[model samples]
Target: MSHFIKQNDPSDLFFPGGLFLNSDTFPTSFFSLFPSSSSSSKASTVSCFSWGPTSRTKVVSVFSVIGGGGGGDFLSLSLSFNSRSNEDHQKHGRESRENVEQHEKKKVCEEEEKENNNVGLVSHGSGAINMTKHLWAGAVAAMVSRTFVAPLERLKLEYIVRGEQRNLFELIQAIATSQGLKGFWKGNFVNILRTAPFKAINFYAYDTYRNKLTRMMGNEESTNFERFVAGAAAGITATLLCLPMDTIRTVMVAPGGEALGGIVGALRHVIKTEGFFSLYKGLVPSIISMAPSGAVFYGVYDILKTAYLHSPEGMKRIEHMKEEDQGLNALEQLELGPFRTLLYGAIAGCCSEAATYPFEVIRRQLQMQVSTTRMNAMATCVKIVEQGGVPALYAGLTPSLLQVLPSAAISYLVYEFMKIVLKVESS
Candidate 1:
């Protein structure tokens, strides 16, 4: 990284990002971090604070900016890092660890008090509270992820419904030209209308399904595959409950859909003209696609979490966490933290989106049709392929991909943080 910058002449000094300095002469010496080892008998040694947050300021090594060789080594730079001695690290870690003796005593006392006070009911109460927390977590996570990626989402829908052959920028340009900048957020109200309920149900249902399936299997805990099944079930549940809004949102941005009017008008128009069943025109494809989509997305995240918990590095990460069972299970008790959660969610999202994208494309096409005669999933696939080759099946995929990474990552991160903040139950 440092090797790329070059200096033109002795009079000119170069910095990164195209910054240049003109100088007739350069300072031969600057104040020393460590006094000249050769010039003085007693050289100053580096010292650092080793207390609390201010700890770890030690200097590993220092190089003089201007060496004794002078002009031969112009602007010589030094690299140094702060590190703690093994003993200091050990001492800090020990002091920071919970007092096991005191913790055990407190636990015993609390358990005795609970037993005497009929606190067994508290478990059920806490579970109910946890459910509420889960709903809050899911709602916020959904709203944030949806709003953050609204533009890309609208663009993706436009590409799908318009069947445009334009690239990402070109599609965005077309929307901007036609409807101006706000077109990028077309139907976002309907989108959000669906999202809160959709994700709240999706997240809560995943947990409920996971627990039931785990118990049905006669297990104390859930496997990653079980998590996958539970997630699929959850997706189907959310889709069924909130799919109407999704359909309305799709048409509002599609070509010729403005006739249907705003969200309420579009919904009423569909029901009045095509019948109530028309609200779910693409239900079949939606369910089929969501199975794999939800499974891969939610399943991969849980799998990553489980894998991390079992890894050596992950074990080290959790050492800082309180040992009490504050989460609902082994999986919940362990965490991957914010950054890791985001990263894993992104990977999961990519896999889910890529795997089920064709179904999504088909589903969107089906949703837009107001005609009595409509194409089935298989027929729609055939039509899309016939129009623009196999690649056409992935027409809006670029914007979808662009939207999903941060969408999934932030969704999971925020959801997890909310769960913590809201004091959701542990195992």
Candidate 2:
């Protein structure tokens, strides 16, 4: 195969929605390095791989601003591979082995480009656009579903504090009898506030880190391990950022006079009685589960997105469409924007919560104790296991599933719609 680099002005490419072209777009330099292929070869291969989140971010932004954007590149690239010959396959394999060295060179080039672009005042107004969209969506969704979260949390707490195995109906009745209908929303506002920002920051951080790391590693693609680190880091950061809010939310949600009174009262009670550190109860388990959950959720979403956008049928349709209708038209785009993000968020939330549901039980128990001396999170886990039996770790799993499935779905859907509406008005 013969290789060549194709460079072009950004204006030469189709402007999907006619948005701002930053400094990089003017007199832009992009490498479309292609491998050379010998004619008469039964099978030929051309693999164009780019590391870093630039393309991903671009697509997301396109979708956010214009209603629809280009789908994941890898998905399309994979489809191209189906027609490759044996010789092409071998060549591709050889190149894959040297992917690391090629990546290092690419990184240097990207860094230089970034520095130069910055000097020219190329503002990334579009930077973090997707992140913002996700954040707003998440916050709105969380707010809409606050009641569900509160009730599930309440049931989970009751199972831990009162040793009750009550059904949802029973739990609802019990909570109503004790705290009234308003009790269902206890600590809800706090949860919405905390979860929205937490989800936004954590999700964006993971994407940012993963892209940067993949680019540095010289890998043409993000490896699972890299994704894991990114997800884990984001999860930890989010947990820490929202820890105080979580503590307050949890205290308020749990049924106890000391915690129920107000934020000030809760703060004083935890400080004067349980000590300042009590605010971080159940932190460990939360951190542990968050990372993998994020990795799986985002990674899977990326993969699926890639596949969908690149499928032969999908590509054919896109290529065949008129310029105006080629990408996503306004109405088509609007219809999909909110629902897609909503589905993505819901899937991530449910999968993550399910994987960590047991830990959720343990954390609530630890927090509800109103007292504990263990400095480490692991010790708390051990203590809970020894005292409550292994089964106790999942006491409220039912309620969690009940609440999370619909709540997440509703929250994400509403969030996406709200974001689109806001974008429409802003535009």
Question: For every model in order, what is the number of clashing pairs?
Answer: 5, 8
- On TM-score, the leading prediction is 1
* Clash pairs, model 1 backbone: 326-426, 327-426, 327-427, 328-426, 328-427
- How far out, in Å, is residue 379 in model 2? 4.3
What is the C-alpha local distance difference test score of candidate 1?
Answer: 0.77
Model 1 lDDT per residue over 167-228, tens place: 77877777799989888777777888889889988989898898889989998878988999
List ranges where model 2 is wrong by over 4 Å. Answer: 1-138, 145-150, 160-162, 177-180, 218-224, 258-260, 312-331, 334-345, 370-379, 411-427
- What is candidate 2's lDDT per residue for 344-367, written digit by digit as tens? 656766676777767666666666
Among these predicted structures, which one has the highest lDDT?
Answer: 1
For every model shown, what is its TM-score relative to the native structure?
A: 0.67, 0.59
Evaluate model 2: give its lDDT: 0.60
* lDDT, each prediction: 0.77, 0.60
